[model samples]
Target: PPEPPTGVPPLDPVDPRYIGPFRLVGRLGAGGMGVVYAGLDDRDRRVAVKCVHRVLATDTDFRERFTREVKLVRRVRAACVPDFFGADTGAEVPWLATEYVPGPTLADFVRTRGPLSGQALAEFAHGVAEALTAIHAAGVVHRDLKPGNVILAPDGPKVLDFGIARATDGTALTRTGGLVGTPGWISPEQYRGAPATDRSDVFAWAGLVVHAATGRGPFGSGTSDVVVSRVLSEPPSLLGVPVHLHAVLHRALSKAPEARPTAAQLQQAVAGLPGTERHADAGSPNRTWAAVSVPLTDPREWIRGAPRKRSWARRHRTALTAVSGVLALALVVGLGVRALTGEDSSLPGEPSGPGGTTGGSAATGGTTSAAGAPDDAPEEYRDLYETGEVVVEPASQDEPVLVRRLEPSSDGGEPLDQLRIDFSEAVSGEFVDFRMTIDLEYLPDHGSLTVHSNEFLGLRAITPGQENLDFRTVGNTGLLAELTPDDPTETVRLTFSGGVAAVYFVPLETRARAQESLDYPGGFCVPRSMSGVSETREVETFPGRDYIGPLDTTLTNGAPLDNCAYTEDSEYQ
Candidate 1:
């Protein structure tokens, strides 16, 4: 057990195994204030055990706050939430246990894949909104509702981590002047030092909806300073958001809390979207998760050098809703519209993920509008077009289908500018074995370009940045690949026969640029195995130039690259 990361504290050597009567197994995840471990009860049922940082565990005030959270959990009666198992604030290393959910976080799902389709987005949003309603009904404010806090189980979405949650009637109140959450997920009221309210959760929930719809956060970046500034003064930008849920997200994440709908109201507003599965316990079958045990190691090595004064500060680097009733009468009618439509959109796959392409970028063609952008673009480029989607094939020991498509807009204005295809859940292989196809209107002067490709994995980590992408994990997941073009058909196809969790494809030229700027050598991009994933495809066009690029660094190996391209000096280069 390396010293826990910022949120989680190092385990006590004298008492490492038990939190009261629950026996600890191994860590499930680590965060700013605590470590969540897989633990078992006498019946052998597995539960997620969260241990409070020793510093806070010993503080009387923090103890009170922690206990309040326990009470709050008990009050929230929604079947969507995990059942509270127990809380032992008095232990040398205080801990709490809740039913364990066996699934990836919603953040992981979208990053590995792409945004949820219109129907899926609607359904997911509805479930989250309803969960928020239940929390508010408990008279507690969740305070934080970000992508990582949401778990998308086989059943539906389950909200987790009530550590910063505050009970309206509890004796403690936000530790007096302390800020209690991740910046991007904090509500405006939270930044203003106002006591949190149910509406506070609404504000954060709104921001999350925007993040889910687009691959970016409403504030544009997840940096703490940027998020704080955006929440305090910026208007929520709804451009590129999945059209069907635009109005709902706009209203929910409104700058003014008053303008936002209540959690219950939001639920009603998004009621009955497609692909939302309602499970009895948010996919926690039998209120337990599979148990796997691994030996724990001393965490001192990783944390020893951290300065004592900054211990708390270091931990702070880290850190939802409801539905509404409307003019209840009007809500009923509107809900019908939402329900009957089932999220209308022409795009293939989920609307929010990396698979779908919206429209022309601001670069090559200025002022082009996305499909749902109130209306279509001007006549000049209206005819020009492009389409993209993330494609996946179940794991196969042999070559897998690899296809690429690029086409100009209706009138042949600009070549289909930027293209990216993300293949998730594909295993990594020693060699990059895949085929590609590209077709485009002829370039004015450039010689016709043809491509042959190959991708490989086996490389060293970038030395300039954090070598350990997962700062707290026991080991790192490393990947490398190379692509070489070999065909001439307007329609190109290739196959990769290997193991990989997923594969990402971008336009050849765009990829060349990304490889150069990103990996430094200018032709390769290797992501650490444990790195967070993203599938965003951002295409921007200048008045006469088209450039395709990534929206954010979802697979950031904790290194800075040149505009998502690989640079010569980069480790992968």
Candidate 2:
């Protein structure tokens, strides 16, 4: 058998034979907490189990954090992270295991393969950006995003080590004045004792991108205080990075989090670098992905360079959780959440054996199609998944439906613009009975959205031969007609068919003057495919310009009704 990316280290005599239910075969790595061992289940499925030290296992705070880590992974359903199997946090040793992703860390990859440049570096940037996008999309911030935490598997880069990741609901595991994260990669806000938000992760992303391109981090390695000082004051060391990436890295490394572009935006920008191979124009055929074929069992991927463990969990092994009651309460409400699509769980026809990185660029409109769809197929979200519920409008020669929304007030006010979609081209056909998903970047706290058409704002239901067909959603158990300020509501997913093509947001309670800004939801239109396999093509941050009222005339000839063209909601105040 070929040696893997994370080589199996021989077990120490003191290591336990089993952590939880799996029988330990060998050790992968060790940290202050405990040993990470290669294990096997009764069926002999391989797993990487991290068993915590007994002394800390009994600690309530550590145990709770470990449980929270499990919860975090459970909620995150992204391909850029390791596949999660199971964890027994309550076990005496408290070990957590995941589908052991086989690949060298970014640190190891660049070190061995030499610094990545050209297309490979750009692809790496896109992969890590997608990983961060997935992490932030799940309401978590990866506080430590150095090269070590990034694994270069067969299927692009996977972001691991959620030990320091904090939920966006303000549920920080760290105490004020106390710090977390590695030195060089830590964001300026983190050094100043500000909270770790999505932008903080972006800053670290900038550092990691720089680090991956060149051997050293953007700030170079140093003692905590020295690195923190430079990170707060000095510009990033982007001398060796490609010139095209300079602008993005500069923006991402901005001292002020407000100035940073989002990971999704970064994915959009970096993937379009000059060296990246161009594809078909939008609405054109030839949807290809950027995939690498490093197998899980490849000896090159599994070669252990060194143990690189850096997270709050790894460093502060015995640290107590000073998480406030309010934060804890918020986390309880936000635990185990699926994003806008509600389809974070595994996708259909996942390529087994080797790393399952497929063909296509992350910048390409949507998610990568697994199988069944030939290259000549339509770019739809339905065909990508083997099983999942969605509603896709059939391809029609007539006018196509388009939806748009004005971003909420930058100051957190009411619905300043219109939310509308022209459903005049609503399709009715047996072949169109496919599932579709509309993913928004940010789902607001309250959902007062009302779907309307040229005729009415909301429709009752679609009647296909008097069957009363309704779009089925797996997660949105209740179609919330009303939401409060404390509501954990984030994603706005529409399960309706041709009539309600899109949703409009009207915040009922965005009260008080805003000292901080809110993230606008992401938009991506998944076209219907004959097969259930589809890709997640990202759309604009908001539909269009901030709070544009609406378009005066109707769109024509299959032209997209840009969000700016959408008229204001007449039913809304």
Candidate 3:
């Protein structure tokens, strides 16, 4: 027997009582493809089921495309996106069911509640960037990421309705003639008819941020064609944005995709904002923030031409002028803010465990306890230990890679010198294919990196073009790779062992709440010297005066050993 429709809305004349096994409860709305209905499963759980329009449902080509796209969308697994439940393309009116998220759209929220501010604003930035990171990692470009597509749910912001998302590998369903996104929030590349990429979505994300903060897009009000033309030609108007976010958003709304930060880069940059939260584990109460130099994917992407000193200060001054006197302190220090004086800033659904990660908090400021320590020391560093995340930006890449900075926990009262590393990202396109390359450390001249790993995952090194000096220390086994003798900008392969390992990207619940994976147990605990007299050093330099790295190893007391080096090289997996 056919299930009866759950009556709650003015349904479309063509709306069916049921699609596949689920009964349609009410019409949610419609997009270019078809009408969406609030659906219920056999056990009465809710799901958002979108059915293809009658006209397109009958077309075999469109049907095949719809089927393939649904499968592709299923690949995304971020908490920001609703869970993909199932899809039935063979049904008369093909439908896709996803976990139904009850919330008002960002557009509706902004229209009614005015603009988001303070911690709410910061959380939204982090959440959206997290979503973009997940989406782009899956190789999908959400061509339509306007406020209307984002829903403000009880938990946090959840990006929904991938009505026009296209796979990055030339799998666009829409033809070339018409615009593929909503105006004002649409990227300039979309207006110019250029193919969309991850960076393109970032451009739209900036517009979304602007709209969320000021209740309007950067382009203001205009006809769709006018808005498209304005996006194509003029710079975004950030008049109403707070000082801290303005500096970041300006770069995000760059006309050139290359000028903008990648989704991963944006995540790093947003951490410095006053309202930006840090990721810490509820289980690991003893573990504090550590300073780490993030490795980039390439060396060339860092050069944005002409480093203007006092530029950030100048922007701070501007933000100060624009904001009320009450926000003076925040405007000046907000860009460099790194507050670590409260409960860990873990977001809703964020996994917590005995092992947690600092998503490059070193970029904001390493936490430190030195009385004479530079005012700019990262906030992630703890007082007694040389532990925290280090953010590295090399010549070859834009995305920041994380390296742990751990020191033997100490009981000393004196300040200690610390270590800093310069890293250039791998230029090889085979990063996806190159499995088993875990646990890497970049050093300068003659210094080697000491790697301490979890039991299941061990660290061992391979020889690169330049030889590593033979050095041994107890409680710490050091592995180091130097720049090729001739070219400081040259690329090299630094391999690792302890059984082939790769970061498992599968999403769902995991045993390790702090571990952001389905399989990998844990990462290495990199040790640093916990002594006094801190200083900074340069690693290497490029022709355009863009040099970043210099091994800064110190000789202070070591912190307590989380896990010492593995003495044996084999017989374990």
Candidate 4:
């Protein structure tokens, strides 16, 4: 027949040549349930055929549950769902066939291309919601609605693999005392041993969208126990998610199943979003997804272009804990909490160090200046550096640090606003670098600051009861800071309806050194000879501002510096 699709591995020696009326051409993938093969029907139409493993095929309970779910899956008719063809439940090795969708999984897409944004992100969310609407309407709950199950085709996104799905009224066939879903994507109620429902799928959908937008699950990455614990207690970190869609997703991820919106309501909310009109208007009539007849490109070509560096098993090992009833037992004994917090026993809102400064060095705690600035700071910009917090010594080169909190503050004067960032551990002066750039062309002025650290790990917001802060600078400047942490370098974009005239760098320690000198020789309000330095310059539009940067300097242990500040001006150029 047509040459097997590239990236489709050749069938193994023990593989069957045929399953019912379809000819197995190549192996697509294998999972806990069975092996999926690329096959062709008598008419030569390509299909994805999933055959139940022999071990599972011998289990009468599994066979009965599979048959029931198969009937429910057949009832699902949606444009965003692959067309189900047929199945043979009575075969020696039961198999089901569906349309062969040639595309990368959403997990692969996001990992390779970075997180989706703007219209693309909106379309992806809307399409998946539409799929859920159709599935739920058919009385089925896709217990596992994760990034791996969504395929990103050129036409649109398609939800795949209903292998773990079941009818709303159907009895689950999970092994006794075992949980039935992926850890990070599974709902809290599911972990609590509740039956999977439509609302549970909604919780998973929100998590999938979060993963698509942030390149990480809502609960963050870790061992299964850690992720499960975070899902049960810690709030999701939506730092990189678009601000507008946060509310709906947050509501959808509510711990209470009754509190979450239904699939239909979720579809409507997603379709009604501000920038999703194009996708919304293109919605299929009768709420059914039309199969795209367009020929797919050779998978080999694209697969080579963006190689999947991590195998499915390797990537999900930590999240694939086959949770047993003992999970509740472990939680009861505080194992979950201990695992969640790791060796660092500090909890949210706990005192990080001396002086209330989150990352202050307890060993050499010192008082602040009269103006609230660190006592060792330069006299010229002391007020600008003051934050009413105790100052600590500079961190050593190997100490790991992270941005633990971000908030707005005043510099005790006019025209300048500050967005203070606190670290989980004291920042290593010798290994940290800061660079800020501003762009004034957009209606709401925007710019970015890069915080690069050799010892930087990731973000960890420790403010109790507040996982995320409202985007606001002093005077309600409407200043929003969106942090995208990519390990070693975290970029924070500042968007506001005002102008930024200058940017300053202040290390909290009394003794810090510079890895390199500042770029702007005369831009500093305070002498460069001092640890703390500032850059004053005119603001310019897009291309013009592209070349202008506040400064780029790496701090080392030497002179005292404390934090960074951005001063706004009405007459900024």
Candidate 5:
């Protein structure tokens, strides 16, 4: 008897009554090519039903591919993959059923939250590796190993959707010019028109690992074209990955197919991994034939740029501003108001009294103010406000347009520095109002600013003002402010000399938390260092700089220490 079609109308007009001896219960998941339904077998066991798309059921090529996938999946029976139950080939929609496993997919889980941690990620990798081993053993290539395909059931990981997979001996189903699999996870070999293999699965797995670690793909976020370019031309860097597991992931992401470990090798290597969760001798029924309604072959069509992180500051700028007063302490030191801490008159190096630094001479006063408080209001409004002194631009008497003074602590206290400048009290004109000063042991000759995701870091120093500045690091990391303000001038500036000094400007509470985890690596307050010092050094004319390529090395080495490179590189897989 022909089994009644599942709930997807037109394909299955009648409600699905039974699939083989199993009684159809409800729908579990759905996709472009199929819909997964919950069902129960003869012994009243729960099962998943995957009903193929009607379009594919009518198309000879799709039908052949679907038939081949069902047969191939039957050969791989392991804990890592859903158990293959039975296929209702007799149904017009060609449904497959597998044991029902409850849990969110790795993709959905990450989407709802973010990336998984080191230990959980490691175990996830191990489980998937084992699954791929079983599939490869049957001479089938999964072709796709993205987070979307892995189900995080209560028991263990279950690899799903072998719809586009190719059997070693089966004929090609996709057209000659057609591309298969997710572009971000696609291996270099795939782009070069090389045959897909177990190694290709490894490459895709590495991309998923990156996504799982940083809540992002290794090459950053973008359209399929951008992601493909990165995979083909660029080498993968495991930034944001835990330092301990860097070596393990490098091997999996190697560009060269021959360079990567085989599924069995990867499985064995990860099996004894130190930090992993395991289940006892529990038995899980095969559910590979489960009814699923996901678009199996059109991955390229569904690939989307990872969602962008919206700044909490931008949404509630006013609330952020209020809270920012509390948080702004880390961001600004001297500009605090009563509502905010009212500006501190004792900024780094201002001489005492009006006769001291402000009014020494319109000549000395102008220069000193320029060097001391560039943002000071014009003398016209000296009494306009209580603390109406400029904190950003200083008087010209301050010497260099941007002067940094550092007083190193002999007692090993916090390294504190100050900048005193005085600009026109003129609240008018196109005044570029911003200040970035740091105190330390020394400064570097050249530097760059790196804006990754939401955080921005001024890596080094070329000069003090716009007259001679180097914009080398502006777009090096491909962080071109896709959604926010693109102009760097609008954002805060960070002026610092090259030197080692423990500096943090996070919220006081966050700063305390960071101090507590000084030894732990990763995340904010982890005590990452930069390369630069501010001690006495010969002044050199700042030079215009050129673009430095992407920093594609280990997180510790490639990323600047003060404004210089000091960390070591990791082995490329």
Candidate 6:
């Protein structure tokens, strides 16, 4: 099995094989709501398939929200957003497919390549603002817009993952009682438990730009509690952020959501920035990927431009003439009408036009009716007007799930290098699972192993045992395990010696759900919806290979556990 693209990892035993007509080739990434896989359509075009976690899909409310949001997400058509292909919300394991963007995430790019600056930073700001404009125009609010959700594609920055997004009409999709967005990137209103709107996304957009300009978030890094407090009380530190963008970002990060500019206004302001001339030129297809060399000027000055100072006489001349004409007409009508009608002045109710009496049209300011005639026509031809707004019934919020504890330990048996994690909340089930991927190509000296859980783990629950697992070496590979728990995704990344040679999953005491089926004789079971067989079944037969086997419950006691082991050696020690 050949390695997939850069950020994409090999599909694990637990992953689905086929989602609808697309063949799942590799794992793009996973999150709380679902797992994203890289798949190929019948036309062989690559797409990203996002499948909701079984735990969440089982909830009727969640499925309804997923179904509704998918409709709204499809309405978003923007260059900065991934193109939506299709979805099956009613499937056993509901999944939606989108265009696969072959680019590193904004978080990964900033971590590996360093913070963006100059023209690259300008374009990034403009592109993200453009994405917000498209999303808001379609009546969808991107509840989560962190660095991880943004992909720095070759064409521009693409905003991905509308998994938590809801319509702008105050439709509550955060049924899970916990806060909807990531810690530092979340806006003040969201922290205060207010419903998220397009303005909330604008606030997030400012924080994202700040993170891109500087390597860190606007609120700074700390535990979730500390970060949340700072976001609520303190002003964002825009220190390393370019001076030109200070005013807009400061206003955008205002404590009051109403103070923030609308997405369209934000786009206009970003488009007016000094080095964003290329962005303003719509006809130019060849965009500059590299940083543009331009002097930093006051963004406010550019955005406002030069004010046209008009003389007082020139401004008031038109207004004075219009007022005089109206007064003269009123006086003449008053005198002539009385003389024509002989004091009563009330006209008979007679048909005044070819269609009918012109009274209705006069009352309606001479507006045309729905029948292509004046509103003065018969009442039967009058048109009933509506605001054209979609009324989405609000959803009730669900109780929040709190983590009682998170325990990490080594599997002291065969394949001693494997690590096992147990959550108090029963995170590993038929629908809920975890993902682990190793990357040894990018960094030469050492490799990295990243493990992500679909469940949310509190910082306090996992911090104490973090040091206990640091000394454990990964099998005979001699790689030390260092746990770096990511708050947003509940992920842990461990640095190891050299690169990853082989990855193996030991059989756990968990059984496949009724909706899943086994892929191979000894391979792990996958979703029944993805039970479609591929045309070719290739197998690897060597050491130092990326081998992810199925969790065979037949060989072990039914204890409901799973573990991952990595070793450079050909055979298990």
Structural similarity to truth (TM-score) of each candidate:
0.45, 0.48, 0.47, 0.49, 0.45, 0.49
Q: Which tens-of-lDDT digit does each residue in 343-456 have in candidate 4? A: 224223322322123232321112344454435534543544343221111122111111111111222332112122322211111212222322111111111122211111
With candidate 4 superimposed using the best TM-score fit, by how many Å does residue 362's alpha carbon deviate from the native? 96
Per-residue lDDT tens digits of candidate 5, residues 1-573?
322223212223564655544566555667654677766553344567788767556666666666677666666667778766666453577887776666667787788867777557766777778888888877678887788888876555778875344521232323532556766877889889898888999888777778877877777778888888888778777888877666767888877899998988887776666656454544332232122113222212111211112121121122211122234233223222111112323233232222122222211121224333223434432222221111111113112232222211122222111222211111111222112332111121111112111111222222111121111111111221111112222222232222211212222212222223221111111112212322221112211111111111111111222222222322100
Candidate 2 lDDT, 455-519, residue by residue in tens: 01111222211211122122322232222224322323333333232222211111000001111
Residue-wise C-alpha lDDT for candidate 6, range 166-266, written one tens digit per residue: 52122222444366778898888888878888889999999999999998999999999999999999989999998999999998999899999998999
Model 1 lDDT vs. the true structure? 0.45
Write the number of the candidate with greater lDDT, choosing between 2 and 6: 6
lDDT for 70 in candidate 6 is: 74
Off by over 4 Å in 1: 1-15, 167-178, 272-573
Model 6 — TM-score against the truth? 0.49
Span of ten consecutive residues with least summed lDDT in model 5: 518-527
Q: Name the runs in model 3 displaced over 4 angstroms.
A: 1-14, 167-177, 278-573
Per-residue error for 298 in candidate 2, Å, reads: 6.6
True lDDT of residue 346, candidate 5: 28
Q: How well does candidate 2 score on lDDT at residue 471? A: 22
Among these predicted structures, which one has the highest lDDT?
4
Which segments of model 5 are wrong by more than 4 Å?
Answer: 1-15, 167-177, 277-573
The per-model lDDT (C-alpha) reads 0.45, 0.47, 0.47, 0.51, 0.45, 0.50
**Alpha-carbon runs more than 4 Å astray in model 2:** 1-6, 163-178, 275-573
Instruction: Please give the lDDT score for candidate 4.
Output: 0.51
